[model samples]
Target: MRKLLTLKHWKNTFAFIYKLLMSKEVAVRDKLLFLIPVIVYWVVPDVLPLIPIDDIAFTMIIAEWFAARMGRKYNIS
Candidate 1:
């Protein structure tokens, strides 16, 4: 568990994320959905009156979905 906290672990994780996002098998809508929460948080003006909580929650859900989908498709644990 402690080994995963190193920079190498993070680099590998990001590499996997990039591969997953760039895969041809993933639909454009799914890619767009993955970017939605991230874009919303950064483009703050459009999300007024609402706290960032919605964006955070959506991001978490999408991240979990993305991880599971990628793991299944790539046959990775």
Candidate 2:
């Protein structure tokens, strides 16, 4: 129906927004700080439990990589 098409369009729009959010120019520290609240919000609700540990770790790794790429290395030791 007409509503389905509109919903699909919105889904793509959100996907694009998410991609832009995770884009390279966002900075690593900023990503972690941003993702912290996002992850917390997604996890604390006990909803969207589909997020896996590996995926979460991978996201952090990517953020750390971006941080290093931006010349802002983090020493967790």
Candidate 3:
């Protein structure tokens, strides 16, 4: 978990996310799998009002998960 807290790790995570999103090899459906939930959450945070997580924090967490999952699935570095 030490890696998760580093600025470099997050930078790499965001970079990977950008690469995956932009790559034409990745299907639109796959891209939407990452984007839809994030957009929905940001637009409707009150859907889970009890949870106190900020919008950006939620996006970052989903981004990290999406990067790792897509990287493995797509054989992306």
Candidate 4:
């Protein structure tokens, strides 16, 4: 999607990730959600005949979602 690939979107996403990692405002439970994907991506087999998608793409989408949620919850720009 165009919205996802924009420079502004990436900037905001990275900013939120940095802020979340740096600040203690977010709960540990929520941070754990991010780890699940990483674990699955590495632990699970990456071969599928029908599905043709990259792990990095899924990770990016999840990152964007996390960033938006963090920004909304913390009222951070």
Please tell me which predicted candidate would have the highest TM-score against the true structure: 3
Which parts of model 1 are misplaced by more than 4 Å?
A: 1-4, 45-65, 73-77
Superposed Cα deviation of residue 31, candidate 2 (Å): 2.7
Candidate 4 per-residue lDDT over residues 1-77, each given as its tens digit: 88777989887787778778677887887777776875676545454434455677777878888887877887766
RMSD of each: 4.3, 12.5, 1.6, 2.6
Full ranking by TM-score: 3, 4, 1, 2
Question: How do the residues 1-77 of candidate 2 rate in per-residue lDDT, one tens digit apiece?
Answer: 45434757455544543554566766566657646765675565476656555554554444444444434332211
TM-score of each: 0.54, 0.34, 0.88, 0.71
Ranking according to lDDT, highest score first? 3, 4, 1, 2
TM-score of 4: 0.71
Q: Best candidate per lDDT, number?
A: 3
For lDDT, candidate 2 versus 3, the one ahead is 3
Task: Assess the local accuracy of residue 10 in candidate 3 as a C-alpha lDDT between 0 and 100.
Answer: 95
Cα error, residue 46 of model 3, in Å, equals 6.4
RMSD of 2: 12.5
Model 4 regions lying over 4 Å from their true place: 46-51
lDDT of 2: 0.51
Candidate 4 lDDT: 0.74
- For candidate 3, list the clashing residue pairs, or say none: none
Query: What is the overall TM-score of model 2 with all chains considered together?
Result: 0.34
